[model samples]
Target: MTVKPDWLRVKAPQLERIGNVKEILRDLALNTVCEEASCPNIGECFNAGTATFLIMGPACTRACPYCDIDFEKKPKPLDPTEPTRLAEAVHRLNLNHVVITSVNRDDLLDGGASQFMACIDAVNSVSPNTTIEVLIPDLCGNWNALELILQAAPEVLNHNTETVPRLYRRVRPQGNYDRTLELLQRTRQLSPSTYTKSGIMVGLGETDAEIRQVMQDLRTVDCDILTIGQYLQPSQKHLQVNEFVNPEQFADWKAFGEEIGFLQVVSSPLTRSSYHAETSQGINETLSTLKS
Candidate 1:
Protein backbone atom coordinates (compact mmCIF):
# COMPACT_ATOMS: atom_id res chain seq x y z
CA MET A 1 0.00 0.00 0.00
CA THR A 2 1.23 3.51 -0.78
CA VAL A 3 1.68 5.91 2.08
CA LYS A 4 -0.99 8.61 2.26
CA PRO A 5 0.31 12.11 1.75
CA ASP A 6 0.31 14.65 4.58
CA TRP A 7 -2.44 16.68 2.95
CA LEU A 8 -4.76 13.64 3.05
CA ARG A 9 -4.54 13.23 6.81
CA VAL A 10 -7.85 13.83 8.57
CA LYS A 11 -8.18 15.17 12.08
CA ALA A 12 -10.17 13.24 14.64
CA PRO A 13 -13.59 14.69 15.39
CA GLN A 14 -15.24 15.16 18.77
CA LEU A 15 -16.30 11.66 19.78
CA GLU A 16 -19.15 12.74 22.06
CA ARG A 17 -21.05 14.34 19.22
CA ILE A 18 -20.25 11.47 16.88
CA GLY A 19 -21.44 9.00 19.52
CA ASN A 20 -24.73 10.88 19.91
CA VAL A 21 -25.38 10.75 16.18
CA LYS A 22 -24.49 7.06 16.04
CA GLU A 23 -26.91 6.36 18.88
CA ILE A 24 -29.75 7.96 16.94
CA LEU A 25 -28.94 5.94 13.78
CA ARG A 26 -28.61 2.69 15.73
CA ASP A 27 -31.84 3.28 17.60
CA LEU A 28 -33.64 3.80 14.33
CA ALA A 29 -31.92 0.81 12.70
CA LEU A 30 -30.72 3.07 9.90
CA ASN A 31 -27.58 2.63 7.77
CA THR A 32 -25.29 5.43 6.65
CA VAL A 33 -22.96 5.58 3.64
CA CYS A 34 -20.44 7.16 5.95
CA GLU A 35 -20.07 3.97 8.00
CA GLU A 36 -20.80 1.51 5.25
CA ALA A 37 -18.46 3.06 2.67
CA SER A 38 -15.77 4.02 5.18
CA CYS A 39 -15.93 7.63 4.12
CA PRO A 40 -13.00 9.66 5.46
CA ASN A 41 -15.38 12.44 6.48
CA ILE A 42 -17.49 10.20 8.75
CA GLY A 43 -16.14 11.55 12.06
CA GLU A 44 -16.33 15.14 10.87
CA CYS A 45 -19.83 14.85 9.43
CA PHE A 46 -21.16 12.88 12.37
CA ASN A 47 -19.62 15.32 14.84
CA ALA A 48 -21.41 18.09 12.99
CA GLY A 49 -24.73 16.23 13.47
CA THR A 50 -25.32 15.16 9.89
CA ALA A 51 -25.15 11.96 7.86
CA THR A 52 -25.85 10.64 4.36
CA PHE A 53 -28.44 7.92 4.93
CA LEU A 54 -27.93 4.68 2.99
CA ILE A 55 -31.43 3.36 2.56
CA MET A 56 -32.40 -0.12 1.23
CA GLY A 57 -29.03 -1.53 2.11
CA PRO A 58 -25.64 -1.87 3.55
CA ALA A 59 -25.06 -4.45 0.79
CA CYS A 60 -24.97 -3.51 -2.86
CA THR A 61 -25.83 -5.68 -5.87
CA ARG A 62 -22.92 -4.45 -7.99
CA ALA A 63 -19.41 -5.01 -6.67
CA CYS A 64 -17.53 -1.90 -7.69
CA PRO A 65 -13.87 -2.39 -6.90
CA TYR A 66 -13.32 1.12 -5.57
CA CYS A 67 -16.15 1.06 -3.04
CA ASP A 68 -15.87 -0.45 0.41
CA ILE A 69 -19.57 -1.35 0.80
CA ASP A 70 -20.15 -5.09 0.92
CA PHE A 71 -21.37 -6.85 -2.25
CA GLU A 72 -21.25 -10.52 -1.24
CA LYS A 73 -24.43 -10.50 0.83
CA LYS A 74 -27.70 -10.71 -1.08
CA PRO A 75 -29.82 -7.58 -1.14
CA LYS A 76 -32.95 -7.85 0.98
CA PRO A 77 -36.46 -6.56 0.47
CA LEU A 78 -37.13 -2.90 1.27
CA ASP A 79 -38.32 -2.40 4.81
CA PRO A 80 -41.57 -0.45 5.03
CA THR A 81 -40.49 1.05 8.34
CA GLU A 82 -37.16 2.37 7.04
CA PRO A 83 -38.37 5.73 5.82
CA THR A 84 -40.18 6.51 9.05
CA ARG A 85 -37.16 5.58 11.11
CA LEU A 86 -34.89 7.71 8.94
CA ALA A 87 -37.30 10.59 9.32
CA GLU A 88 -37.27 10.19 13.07
CA ALA A 89 -33.50 10.37 13.13
CA VAL A 90 -33.54 13.54 11.01
CA HIS A 91 -36.11 15.12 13.30
CA ARG A 92 -34.15 14.16 16.39
CA LEU A 93 -30.90 15.50 15.03
CA ASN A 94 -32.59 18.72 13.84
CA LEU A 95 -30.84 18.59 10.48
CA ASN A 96 -31.38 21.44 8.06
CA HIS A 97 -30.11 19.36 5.11
CA VAL A 98 -30.04 15.59 4.69
CA VAL A 99 -28.45 13.43 1.98
CA ILE A 100 -30.05 10.08 1.28
CA THR A 101 -28.06 7.56 -0.81
CA SER A 102 -28.40 3.86 -1.47
CA VAL A 103 -26.42 0.87 -2.56
CA ASN A 104 -27.39 -0.33 -6.03
CA ARG A 105 -30.26 -2.79 -5.59
CA ASP A 106 -30.41 -4.05 -9.17
CA ASP A 107 -32.53 -6.92 -7.92
CA LEU A 108 -35.57 -4.65 -7.53
CA LEU A 109 -37.85 -3.83 -10.45
CA ASP A 110 -37.83 -0.06 -9.85
CA GLY A 111 -34.23 -0.25 -8.72
CA GLY A 112 -35.30 0.95 -5.29
CA ALA A 113 -36.73 4.19 -6.65
CA SER A 114 -39.95 3.73 -4.68
CA GLN A 115 -37.97 3.25 -1.50
CA PHE A 116 -36.25 6.55 -2.20
CA MET A 117 -39.62 8.21 -2.71
CA ALA A 118 -40.91 6.77 0.54
CA CYS A 119 -37.85 8.05 2.37
CA ILE A 120 -38.28 11.51 0.86
CA ASP A 121 -41.96 11.61 1.79
CA ALA A 122 -41.25 10.40 5.29
CA VAL A 123 -38.58 13.07 5.80
CA ASN A 124 -40.84 15.78 4.45
CA SER A 125 -43.64 14.80 6.78
CA VAL A 126 -41.51 15.05 9.92
CA SER A 127 -39.05 17.75 8.90
CA PRO A 128 -40.71 19.95 6.34
CA ASN A 129 -38.05 22.61 6.67
CA THR A 130 -35.18 20.25 5.98
CA THR A 131 -33.97 20.19 2.39
CA ILE A 132 -33.44 16.73 0.85
CA GLU A 133 -30.64 15.51 -1.42
CA VAL A 134 -30.57 11.97 -2.78
CA LEU A 135 -27.38 10.39 -4.16
CA ILE A 136 -28.92 7.75 -6.38
CA PRO A 137 -27.76 4.87 -8.55
CA ASP A 138 -28.15 4.70 -12.38
CA LEU A 139 -31.36 2.61 -12.13
CA CYS A 140 -30.00 0.56 -15.07
CA GLY A 141 -31.22 3.16 -17.58
CA ASN A 142 -34.77 2.88 -16.32
CA TRP A 143 -36.04 6.34 -17.22
CA ASN A 144 -39.45 5.50 -15.81
CA ALA A 145 -37.94 4.78 -12.44
CA LEU A 146 -35.93 7.99 -12.67
CA GLU A 147 -39.14 9.88 -13.32
CA LEU A 148 -40.69 8.37 -10.23
CA ILE A 149 -37.85 9.75 -8.10
CA LEU A 150 -38.01 13.16 -9.77
CA GLN A 151 -41.76 13.32 -9.21
CA ALA A 152 -41.07 13.09 -5.50
CA ALA A 153 -39.37 16.51 -5.80
CA PRO A 154 -36.17 16.27 -3.82
CA GLU A 155 -34.30 19.56 -3.46
CA VAL A 156 -31.22 18.04 -5.10
CA LEU A 157 -30.90 15.05 -7.46
CA ASN A 158 -27.36 13.63 -7.29
CA HIS A 159 -25.98 10.74 -9.34
CA ASN A 160 -22.28 10.06 -9.25
CA THR A 161 -20.28 9.71 -12.48
CA GLU A 162 -17.62 8.13 -10.30
CA THR A 163 -14.87 7.93 -12.93
CA VAL A 164 -13.89 9.09 -16.38
CA PRO A 165 -15.03 7.17 -19.46
CA ARG A 166 -11.61 5.70 -20.16
CA LEU A 167 -11.49 3.89 -16.83
CA TYR A 168 -15.13 2.86 -16.78
CA ARG A 169 -14.44 -0.76 -17.68
CA ARG A 170 -11.84 -1.33 -14.98
CA VAL A 171 -12.80 1.13 -12.23
CA ARG A 172 -16.55 0.94 -12.53
CA PRO A 173 -17.20 -2.23 -14.49
CA GLN A 174 -20.99 -2.14 -14.39
CA GLY A 175 -21.25 1.65 -14.75
CA ASN A 176 -21.67 3.29 -18.14
CA TYR A 177 -20.23 6.77 -18.64
CA ASP A 178 -22.83 7.78 -21.19
CA ARG A 179 -25.60 6.40 -19.02
CA THR A 180 -24.35 8.44 -16.07
CA LEU A 181 -24.44 11.60 -18.17
CA GLU A 182 -27.89 10.73 -19.50
CA LEU A 183 -29.23 10.36 -15.97
CA LEU A 184 -28.01 13.85 -15.10
CA GLN A 185 -29.36 15.19 -18.38
CA ARG A 186 -32.75 13.65 -17.71
CA THR A 187 -32.79 15.08 -14.19
CA ARG A 188 -32.21 18.60 -15.51
CA GLN A 189 -34.91 18.21 -18.16
CA LEU A 190 -37.49 16.70 -15.80
CA SER A 191 -36.96 19.11 -12.92
CA PRO A 192 -35.30 22.30 -14.01
CA SER A 193 -35.62 23.65 -10.51
CA THR A 194 -33.90 20.71 -8.88
CA TYR A 195 -30.12 21.01 -8.50
CA THR A 196 -28.16 18.33 -10.34
CA LYS A 197 -24.94 17.12 -8.71
CA SER A 198 -22.21 14.56 -9.51
CA GLY A 199 -18.91 13.43 -7.99
CA ILE A 200 -15.59 11.90 -9.15
CA MET A 201 -12.61 10.47 -7.32
CA VAL A 202 -9.00 11.12 -8.37
CA GLY A 203 -5.80 9.02 -7.93
CA LEU A 204 -6.99 5.89 -9.67
CA GLY A 205 -4.57 6.46 -12.58
CA GLU A 206 -6.52 9.13 -14.44
CA THR A 207 -4.65 11.94 -16.12
CA ASP A 208 -5.26 15.62 -15.39
CA ALA A 209 -6.65 16.16 -18.86
CA GLU A 210 -9.10 13.28 -18.48
CA ILE A 211 -10.36 14.79 -15.24
CA ARG A 212 -10.92 18.15 -16.89
CA GLN A 213 -12.71 16.51 -19.81
CA VAL A 214 -15.08 14.79 -17.40
CA MET A 215 -15.79 18.14 -15.77
CA GLN A 216 -16.57 19.63 -19.17
CA ASP A 217 -18.90 16.75 -20.00
CA LEU A 218 -20.75 17.37 -16.74
CA ARG A 219 -21.10 21.07 -17.56
CA THR A 220 -22.41 20.19 -21.02
CA VAL A 221 -25.26 18.31 -19.35
CA ASP A 222 -25.96 21.43 -17.24
CA CYS A 223 -24.93 19.79 -14.00
CA ASP A 224 -25.23 22.42 -11.31
CA ILE A 225 -22.80 21.07 -8.74
CA LEU A 226 -19.60 18.98 -8.80
CA THR A 227 -17.44 17.24 -6.20
CA ILE A 228 -13.90 15.99 -6.93
CA GLY A 229 -11.93 14.05 -4.36
CA GLN A 230 -8.96 11.76 -3.96
CA TYR A 231 -9.63 8.02 -3.89
CA LEU A 232 -8.24 6.04 -0.98
CA GLN A 233 -8.00 2.28 -1.03
CA PRO A 234 -10.29 0.81 1.63
CA SER A 235 -8.37 -2.46 1.79
CA GLN A 236 -5.57 -4.33 0.03
CA LYS A 237 -8.16 -6.31 -1.89
CA HIS A 238 -9.66 -3.15 -3.39
CA LEU A 239 -8.11 -1.14 -6.24
CA GLN A 240 -4.67 0.16 -5.32
CA VAL A 241 -4.04 3.89 -5.29
CA ASN A 242 -2.50 4.94 -8.59
CA GLU A 243 -1.34 8.34 -7.41
CA PHE A 244 -1.69 10.80 -4.55
CA VAL A 245 -2.83 14.05 -6.09
CA ASN A 246 -1.66 17.11 -4.23
CA PRO A 247 -3.97 19.78 -2.77
CA GLU A 248 -2.85 22.43 -5.25
CA GLN A 249 -3.93 20.23 -8.16
CA PHE A 250 -7.35 19.80 -6.59
CA ALA A 251 -7.66 23.58 -6.27
CA ASP A 252 -6.79 23.85 -9.94
CA TRP A 253 -9.56 21.41 -10.79
CA LYS A 254 -12.04 23.48 -8.78
CA ALA A 255 -10.98 26.55 -10.70
CA PHE A 256 -11.35 24.74 -14.00
CA GLY A 257 -14.80 23.46 -13.08
CA GLU A 258 -15.97 26.93 -12.11
CA GLU A 259 -14.45 28.36 -15.32
CA ILE A 260 -16.53 25.91 -17.31
CA GLY A 261 -19.75 27.26 -15.70
CA PHE A 262 -20.59 24.75 -12.97
CA LEU A 263 -22.85 26.50 -10.47
CA GLN A 264 -20.71 25.16 -7.63
CA VAL A 265 -17.49 23.14 -7.51
CA VAL A 266 -16.05 21.40 -4.45
CA SER A 267 -12.59 19.94 -5.14
CA SER A 268 -10.25 18.67 -2.49
CA PRO A 269 -8.65 15.49 -1.23
CA LEU A 270 -11.42 14.84 1.28
CA THR A 271 -14.44 16.18 -0.57
CA ARG A 272 -17.12 13.49 -0.94
CA SER A 273 -20.41 13.66 -2.81
CA SER A 274 -22.22 14.66 0.37
CA TYR A 275 -19.41 16.32 2.29
CA HIS A 276 -20.30 19.92 3.11
CA ALA A 277 -23.34 19.28 0.92
CA GLU A 278 -25.47 21.78 2.79
CA THR A 279 -23.36 24.61 1.39
CA SER A 280 -24.98 24.15 -2.03
CA GLN A 281 -28.01 26.01 -0.63
CA GLY A 282 -26.23 29.12 -1.87
CA ILE A 283 -26.95 27.87 -5.39
CA ASN A 284 -30.68 28.34 -4.83
CA GLU A 285 -30.17 32.05 -4.30
CA THR A 286 -27.78 32.18 -7.27
CA LEU A 287 -30.24 30.49 -9.60
CA SER A 288 -33.07 32.68 -8.39
CA THR A 289 -30.94 35.73 -9.18
CA LEU A 290 -30.13 34.42 -12.65
CA LYS A 291 -33.82 33.87 -13.39
CA SER A 292 -34.84 37.26 -12.15
Candidate 2:
Protein backbone atom coordinates (compact mmCIF):
# COMPACT_ATOMS: atom_id res chain seq x y z
CA MET A 1 0.00 0.00 0.00
CA THR A 2 1.19 3.48 -0.83
CA VAL A 3 1.75 6.09 1.88
CA LYS A 4 -1.06 8.64 2.13
CA PRO A 5 -0.28 11.67 0.04
CA ASP A 6 -0.07 15.21 1.43
CA TRP A 7 -2.94 16.44 -0.76
CA LEU A 8 -5.27 14.23 1.25
CA ARG A 9 -4.64 16.31 4.38
CA VAL A 10 -7.41 18.65 5.55
CA LYS A 11 -7.38 21.52 8.02
CA ALA A 12 -9.21 20.71 11.21
CA PRO A 13 -12.74 22.16 11.33
CA GLN A 14 -12.05 24.61 14.20
CA LEU A 15 -14.54 27.33 13.38
CA GLU A 16 -16.24 28.47 16.61
CA ARG A 17 -19.64 28.33 14.87
CA ILE A 18 -19.12 24.58 14.41
CA GLY A 19 -20.31 24.09 17.97
CA ASN A 20 -23.56 25.76 17.00
CA VAL A 21 -24.30 23.03 14.45
CA LYS A 22 -23.16 20.33 16.86
CA GLU A 23 -25.62 21.70 19.36
CA ILE A 24 -28.54 20.96 17.01
CA LEU A 25 -27.50 17.31 16.74
CA ARG A 26 -27.01 17.11 20.51
CA ASP A 27 -30.38 18.68 21.19
CA LEU A 28 -32.27 16.59 18.67
CA ALA A 29 -30.21 13.43 19.22
CA LEU A 30 -29.48 12.98 15.50
CA ASN A 31 -26.60 11.07 13.98
CA THR A 32 -24.66 12.20 10.93
CA VAL A 33 -22.56 10.21 8.47
CA CYS A 34 -19.94 12.97 8.74
CA GLU A 35 -19.09 11.71 12.22
CA GLU A 36 -20.12 8.06 12.11
CA ALA A 37 -18.27 7.38 8.85
CA SER A 38 -15.28 9.41 10.05
CA CYS A 39 -15.50 11.53 6.91
CA PRO A 40 -12.46 13.77 6.49
CA ASN A 41 -14.59 16.86 5.80
CA ILE A 42 -16.58 16.72 9.07
CA GLY A 43 -15.06 19.93 10.46
CA GLU A 44 -15.52 21.91 7.25
CA CYS A 45 -19.08 20.68 6.71
CA PHE A 46 -20.21 21.09 10.32
CA ASN A 47 -18.50 24.46 10.56
CA ALA A 48 -20.61 25.45 7.56
CA GLY A 49 -23.74 24.25 9.40
CA THR A 50 -24.45 21.36 7.00
CA ALA A 51 -24.34 17.60 7.53
CA THR A 52 -25.69 14.33 6.09
CA PHE A 53 -28.24 13.00 8.59
CA LEU A 54 -27.60 9.29 9.15
CA ILE A 55 -30.94 7.75 10.03
CA MET A 56 -31.55 4.47 11.91
CA GLY A 57 -28.52 3.69 14.05
CA PRO A 58 -24.85 4.12 13.48
CA ALA A 59 -24.46 0.32 13.45
CA CYS A 60 -24.58 -1.51 10.12
CA THR A 61 -25.72 -5.05 9.34
CA ARG A 62 -22.95 -5.92 6.91
CA ALA A 63 -19.27 -5.80 7.90
CA CYS A 64 -17.75 -4.08 4.90
CA PRO A 65 -14.11 -4.01 5.98
CA TYR A 66 -13.44 -0.69 4.26
CA CYS A 67 -16.32 1.00 6.08
CA ASP A 68 -15.96 2.88 9.32
CA ILE A 69 -19.42 2.30 10.85
CA ASP A 70 -19.81 -0.36 13.53
CA PHE A 71 -21.22 -3.74 12.50
CA GLU A 72 -23.90 -5.81 14.21
CA LYS A 73 -25.95 -8.65 12.76
CA LYS A 74 -28.88 -7.78 15.01
CA PRO A 75 -29.06 -4.04 15.60
CA LYS A 76 -31.58 -2.44 17.92
CA PRO A 77 -35.17 -1.69 17.14
CA LEU A 78 -35.89 1.36 14.99
CA ASP A 79 -36.67 4.42 17.06
CA PRO A 80 -40.12 5.74 16.31
CA THR A 81 -39.06 9.15 17.58
CA GLU A 82 -36.02 9.25 15.31
CA PRO A 83 -38.00 10.69 12.40
CA THR A 84 -39.48 13.41 14.56
CA ARG A 85 -36.12 14.22 16.07
CA LEU A 86 -34.50 14.32 12.63
CA ALA A 87 -37.27 16.58 11.42
CA GLU A 88 -36.77 18.82 14.43
CA ALA A 89 -33.12 19.17 13.58
CA VAL A 90 -33.93 20.22 10.01
CA HIS A 91 -36.50 22.68 11.26
CA ARG A 92 -34.18 24.14 13.87
CA LEU A 93 -31.33 24.46 11.44
CA ASN A 94 -33.55 26.25 8.90
CA LEU A 95 -32.07 24.10 6.18
CA ASN A 96 -33.51 24.14 2.69
CA HIS A 97 -31.65 21.03 1.51
CA VAL A 98 -31.10 17.90 3.59
CA VAL A 99 -29.36 14.57 2.95
CA ILE A 100 -30.61 11.43 4.72
CA THR A 101 -28.94 8.00 4.71
CA SER A 102 -29.04 4.89 6.85
CA VAL A 103 -27.31 1.68 7.83
CA ASN A 104 -28.03 -1.57 5.98
CA ARG A 105 -31.00 -3.11 7.82
CA ASP A 106 -31.32 -6.48 6.09
CA ASP A 107 -32.67 -7.65 9.41
CA LEU A 108 -35.84 -5.61 8.83
CA LEU A 109 -38.61 -6.89 6.61
CA ASP A 110 -38.48 -3.85 4.33
CA GLY A 111 -34.80 -3.27 4.89
CA GLY A 112 -35.42 0.07 6.64
CA ALA A 113 -37.22 1.68 3.70
CA SER A 114 -40.19 2.49 5.93
CA GLN A 115 -37.91 4.37 8.29
CA PHE A 116 -36.54 6.31 5.32
CA MET A 117 -40.07 7.17 4.27
CA ALA A 118 -40.95 8.24 7.80
CA CYS A 119 -37.90 10.47 8.06
CA ILE A 120 -38.70 12.02 4.68
CA ASP A 121 -42.32 12.52 5.67
CA ALA A 122 -41.40 14.09 9.00
CA VAL A 123 -38.94 16.47 7.42
CA ASN A 124 -41.44 17.37 4.74
CA SER A 125 -44.13 18.05 7.32
CA VAL A 126 -42.01 20.57 9.20
CA SER A 127 -39.77 21.79 6.42
CA PRO A 128 -41.94 21.41 3.38
CA ASN A 129 -39.77 23.72 1.36
CA THR A 130 -36.72 21.63 2.07
CA THR A 131 -35.55 19.38 -0.77
CA ILE A 132 -34.42 15.91 0.30
CA GLU A 133 -31.82 13.53 -1.09
CA VAL A 134 -31.47 9.98 0.18
CA LEU A 135 -28.30 7.85 -0.07
CA ILE A 136 -29.76 4.38 0.18
CA PRO A 137 -28.53 0.82 0.39
CA ASP A 138 -29.24 -2.04 -2.06
CA LEU A 139 -31.89 -3.37 0.39
CA CYS A 140 -30.57 -6.83 -0.33
CA GLY A 141 -32.03 -6.64 -3.85
CA ASN A 142 -35.49 -5.83 -2.54
CA TRP A 143 -36.88 -3.82 -5.46
CA ASN A 144 -40.14 -3.33 -3.61
CA ALA A 145 -38.33 -1.49 -0.83
CA LEU A 146 -36.68 0.72 -3.43
CA GLU A 147 -40.09 1.58 -4.89
CA LEU A 148 -41.43 2.37 -1.42
CA ILE A 149 -38.68 4.91 -0.81
CA LEU A 150 -39.08 6.38 -4.29
CA GLN A 151 -42.79 6.86 -3.65
CA ALA A 152 -41.77 9.55 -1.17
CA ALA A 153 -40.33 11.42 -4.21
CA PRO A 154 -37.13 12.83 -2.80
CA GLU A 155 -35.54 15.57 -4.90
CA VAL A 156 -32.60 13.32 -5.63
CA LEU A 157 -32.11 9.57 -5.17
CA ASN A 158 -28.49 8.51 -4.63
CA HIS A 159 -26.88 5.10 -4.16
CA ASN A 160 -23.12 4.80 -4.13
CA THR A 161 -21.27 2.13 -6.07
CA GLU A 162 -18.40 2.53 -3.63
CA THR A 163 -15.85 0.48 -5.50
CA VAL A 164 -15.40 -1.26 -8.83
CA PRO A 165 -16.67 -4.79 -9.51
CA ARG A 166 -13.32 -6.52 -9.10
CA LEU A 167 -12.86 -5.02 -5.64
CA TYR A 168 -16.37 -5.91 -4.39
CA ARG A 169 -15.57 -9.20 -2.70
CA ARG A 170 -12.44 -7.91 -0.98
CA VAL A 171 -13.44 -4.29 -0.28
CA ARG A 172 -17.19 -4.55 0.06
CA PRO A 173 -17.74 -8.23 0.62
CA GLN A 174 -21.54 -8.00 0.93
CA GLY A 175 -22.22 -5.49 -1.85
CA ASN A 176 -23.13 -6.56 -5.40
CA TYR A 177 -22.00 -4.24 -8.21
CA ASP A 178 -24.74 -5.25 -10.64
CA ARG A 179 -27.43 -4.97 -7.97
CA THR A 180 -26.39 -1.41 -7.22
CA LEU A 181 -26.58 -0.51 -10.92
CA GLU A 182 -29.98 -2.11 -11.19
CA LEU A 183 -31.16 -0.03 -8.25
CA LEU A 184 -30.06 3.13 -10.02
CA GLN A 185 -31.65 1.90 -13.25
CA ARG A 186 -34.90 1.10 -11.49
CA THR A 187 -34.89 4.48 -9.80
CA ARG A 188 -35.15 6.03 -13.24
CA GLN A 189 -37.78 3.51 -14.31
CA LEU A 190 -39.91 4.17 -11.22
CA SER A 191 -39.37 7.91 -10.79
CA PRO A 192 -38.16 9.33 -14.06
CA SER A 193 -38.72 12.84 -12.76
CA THR A 194 -36.50 12.27 -9.77
CA TYR A 195 -32.85 12.93 -10.63
CA THR A 196 -30.77 9.77 -10.17
CA LYS A 197 -27.17 10.06 -8.94
CA SER A 198 -24.38 7.61 -8.04
CA GLY A 199 -20.82 7.95 -6.80
CA ILE A 200 -17.64 5.82 -6.67
CA MET A 201 -14.39 6.26 -4.77
CA VAL A 202 -11.02 5.92 -6.45
CA GLY A 203 -7.68 4.78 -4.93
CA LEU A 204 -9.12 1.40 -4.02
CA GLY A 205 -6.81 -0.40 -6.46
CA GLU A 206 -9.25 0.26 -9.30
CA THR A 207 -7.83 1.17 -12.68
CA ASP A 208 -8.71 4.18 -14.81
CA ALA A 209 -10.37 1.90 -17.39
CA GLU A 210 -12.54 0.39 -14.67
CA ILE A 211 -13.50 3.82 -13.34
CA ARG A 212 -14.55 5.04 -16.79
CA GLN A 213 -16.43 1.81 -17.37
CA VAL A 214 -18.33 2.41 -14.13
CA MET A 215 -19.17 5.91 -15.29
CA GLN A 216 -20.35 4.51 -18.60
CA ASP A 217 -22.48 1.99 -16.79
CA LEU A 218 -24.08 4.79 -14.77
CA ARG A 219 -24.89 6.71 -17.95
CA THR A 220 -26.42 3.54 -19.36
CA VAL A 221 -28.83 3.57 -16.43
CA ASP A 222 -29.63 7.17 -17.41
CA CYS A 223 -28.05 8.53 -14.26
CA ASP A 224 -28.13 12.31 -14.17
CA ILE A 225 -25.26 13.16 -11.83
CA LEU A 226 -21.94 11.65 -10.75
CA THR A 227 -19.62 12.29 -7.81
CA ILE A 228 -16.09 10.88 -7.72
CA GLY A 229 -13.64 11.27 -4.86
CA GLN A 230 -10.55 9.82 -3.27
CA TYR A 231 -10.98 6.93 -0.84
CA LEU A 232 -9.50 7.77 2.55
CA GLN A 233 -8.81 4.88 4.88
CA PRO A 234 -10.72 5.52 8.11
CA SER A 235 -8.53 3.48 10.48
CA GLN A 236 -5.45 1.32 10.70
CA LYS A 237 -7.70 -1.70 10.95
CA HIS A 238 -9.38 -0.86 7.65
CA LEU A 239 -8.00 -1.32 4.17
CA GLN A 240 -4.92 0.72 3.38
CA VAL A 241 -4.77 3.33 0.65
CA ASN A 242 -4.11 1.75 -2.73
CA GLU A 243 -3.16 5.11 -4.25
CA PHE A 244 -4.06 8.76 -3.81
CA VAL A 245 -5.72 10.05 -7.00
CA ASN A 246 -4.79 13.68 -7.64
CA PRO A 247 -6.90 16.78 -8.34
CA GLU A 248 -6.16 16.76 -12.07
CA GLN A 249 -7.51 13.23 -12.40
CA PHE A 250 -10.70 14.16 -10.59
CA ALA A 251 -11.13 17.15 -12.92
CA ASP A 252 -10.71 14.88 -15.89
CA TRP A 253 -13.43 12.56 -14.63
CA LYS A 254 -15.75 15.51 -14.04
CA ALA A 255 -15.36 16.69 -17.61
CA PHE A 256 -15.69 13.17 -18.89
CA GLY A 257 -18.96 12.68 -17.04
CA GLU A 258 -20.48 15.84 -18.47
CA GLU A 259 -19.26 15.01 -21.94
CA ILE A 260 -21.05 11.68 -21.71
CA GLY A 261 -24.40 13.38 -20.86
CA PHE A 262 -24.35 13.67 -17.08
CA LEU A 263 -26.16 16.86 -16.22
CA GLN A 264 -23.57 17.66 -13.55
CA VAL A 265 -20.40 16.14 -12.19
CA VAL A 266 -18.77 16.83 -8.81
CA SER A 267 -15.31 15.26 -8.71
CA SER A 268 -12.48 15.95 -6.31
CA PRO A 269 -10.66 14.46 -3.36
CA LEU A 270 -13.04 16.06 -0.83
CA THR A 271 -16.18 15.29 -2.82
CA ARG A 272 -18.42 12.89 -0.88
CA SER A 273 -22.03 12.12 -1.86
CA SER A 274 -23.27 15.08 0.16
CA TYR A 275 -20.28 17.33 -0.25
CA HIS A 276 -21.64 20.69 -1.29
CA ALA A 277 -24.90 18.81 -1.65
CA GLU A 278 -26.91 22.00 -1.70
CA THR A 279 -25.89 22.37 -5.34
CA SER A 280 -28.33 19.58 -6.02
CA GLN A 281 -31.17 22.07 -5.80
CA GLY A 282 -30.24 23.49 -9.18
CA ILE A 283 -29.93 20.09 -10.83
CA ASN A 284 -33.35 19.09 -9.54
CA GLU A 285 -34.92 22.28 -10.87
CA THR A 286 -33.41 21.80 -14.30
CA LEU A 287 -34.57 18.19 -14.48
CA SER A 288 -38.05 19.17 -13.29
CA THR A 289 -38.40 21.85 -15.94
CA LEU A 290 -37.24 19.49 -18.68
CA LYS A 291 -39.75 16.86 -17.61
CA SER A 292 -42.56 19.41 -17.42
For candidate 1, write residues 130-242 as lDDT tens digits.
78899999999999999999898898899999988999999999999999999999999998988999999999999999999999999999999999999999998999999
Q: Which ten residues in a row have the lowest lDDT in candidate 2?
A: 283-292
In candidate 2, position 64 carries an lDDT of 87
Question: What is candidate 1's TM-score against the reference?
Answer: 0.97
lDDT of 2 by residue, 1-292 (tens): 5676788888977767679988889888888998899998888888777889998878889998888998954688999999999999998888768999999888999999999999999998998888888999999999999999989888889999988899999998999999999999999999988888888988889998999999999999999888999988888899988888999999999889889999889999988989988754347566344424
Quote the positional error of residue 64 for candidate 2 in Å.
0.7
Candidate that scores best on TM-score: 1
In model 2, residue pairs whose N, Cα or C atoms come closer than 3 Å (at least 3 residues apart or on different chains), thus clashing, are: none
Question: Once superposed on the true structure, which residue ranges of model 2 sit more than 4 Å away at CA?
Answer: 1-3, 72-74, 280-292
- Off by more than 4 A, model 1: 284-292
- Alpha-carbon local distance difference test for all models: 0.92, 0.88
After the best TM-score superposition of candidate 1, give how far the Cα of residue 179 lies from its true spot, in angstroms: 0.3
TM-scores for all candidates: the values are 0.97, 0.95
